[model samples]
Target: MTTSAPEPVAHGVGRVRVPMPPGTGLPFSNAYLIDDGDGRVHVVDPGSPTAEARAVLEAAIGDTEVGSIVITHLHADHAGGAAALRARTGAPVLLHERERDALGRIAIGVVPPDLEAWGVPEDRRPELLAAAVVPTAPAATLADQVVEGALGDAQLLDIPGRRVRVIGTPGHTDGHLCLHDEEADLLFTGDHILPTVNSGLGLGGPTDTNPIADYLASLDRAAELDTGTLRALPGHEDPFTGVRERCAALAAHHLRRTEEVAASSGATVWEVASTLTWTGGWDALAGFTLLSALRQTAQHRELVSRRRGL
Candidate 1:
């Protein structure tokens, strides 16, 4: 369900909640519109591809020149509308270099083959395979198009009123980025640190590093940014303070699971996952949900193994 229209967060910042299609997991994802003091705008994480969402974003943009479409990551709920928005506004879309390549591969039907290796039983394999189907751009012409430019770590964007620096935080996805508004003491954490959800790790494109390890290191990086009182404007939840506490909590949450998976060594990913705790219990998860559980469990096990020299 979409919430109210875009509301101001700061002098030049506003947040809009774009409703996802029913049963998409989240109630609504957020997109941010930033004014450059001039008439130009920089849109962040234009969520979803629905007409309704487009309408909401359009209303928020009003008559401003769209300077750039900046994507925090390439997840469907975050970057699904990039191509469409770019087409309409003629604004260049910017993404992390790794995510650009990952999205391109996804558009061409190159997906991960880790499912079979997870040792899921044959009876449940179909559901997992179905879950792995990622939606690409609406048109074949836009399918291979991800972004027009790349945002590197620590690079400052040329937005109007804000000195926004891109911070590379890989874990949720390799090349995941968070934008820091130093002037405002605000950090735009894109699914890297949420208020409520312990968002699944390694859920993005394939990565060469261990996702759990990367996630922990990313948390540390986030902690260092907490000027003791920095506020965080996350992708899914409302704006929050205590950035250090939130970052520590997210890290501890995963490390606890790492301990659980560590104890279940020598078991297959599916078997180990079946023994761990889930939101609705292990047996209740199926299809993509179950596959996600298994994959994260596998990632945790690998992280533990690497640490212990197993």
Candidate 2:
């Protein structure tokens, strides 16, 4: 439940659904507060970068000391308010070492998708390229959000009475993570396995390994947890049970997508993406939407090729 005062989300976690920029296709981001039972609270996923969003968080924090700022990933919505919060409270922001490295890469700017390589028609190229510069969240600037510490796989938080372990579940991004509270049986799954939507793969910078393969393995790894009782608190949606079922469903969806890509007739990424199903039909995709679709199609095709050893 969304609340200004600290409310129990599970055994020790409190939640605040921080707002996002308009037309972002998402209404709010879940900012979890884990109290250390020692007057300090650890903040996770600080939500969109805005003075309004920061006001909400600062009010929720209310007189309590900030123990640390932990980021699950490097998305603007999740890591946006981090800079301001750290500037205000001097809380050392902690992220996975992989994610920290990714931030360094992002600050230098990432390469845009090769439209010609994807075989996009010359007419559609300008619009797609122009959309790249329009800021989706003008208030949420990511270039300034820096990391002061690195979190490793299975690394425990320094809270005296908690046993929260950071699980490196890289799929949605190159350095995505999920926090598993062994004592409380709660997993703070940050876009790794959402209750409502299937997160895209390899949205981060260029990776040497195949994203589909990495995502599939990550799904299996998350399924290893106790699915019957462990509740997941996602970055967007509300908390839920049935971890195993959710993991299986996500995996099946990806596998089926790979099979569809394998069967589709196409000599290029654009051609195959056109034949695939989209929420508003393939012709409706443009700009960032089109870019994302082509990238995902390319990843699926790579997965099929790897499995066949081609």
Task: Show how many residue pairs clash in every candidate, following the order shown.
Answer: 0, 0
Tell me the deviation in Å of residue 48 in model 2.
0.4
lDDT of each: 0.79, 0.81
Model 2: colliding residue pairs: none
- Predicted candidate 1 versus true structure: per-residue lDDT over 1-310, tens digit per residue: 3334478887678998888888877888889988887778899999888897788878777767889988888777888777778888888878777666666665566475466677777887776777766533332333355445688889999897789999888888877889998888888898999998887777765667887888889888888999987888889979889889988888888888888887774467878888787878987887767767887888888788788998
The candidate scoring highest on lDDT is 2
Q: What TM-score would each prediction reach against the true structure?
A: 0.92, 0.92
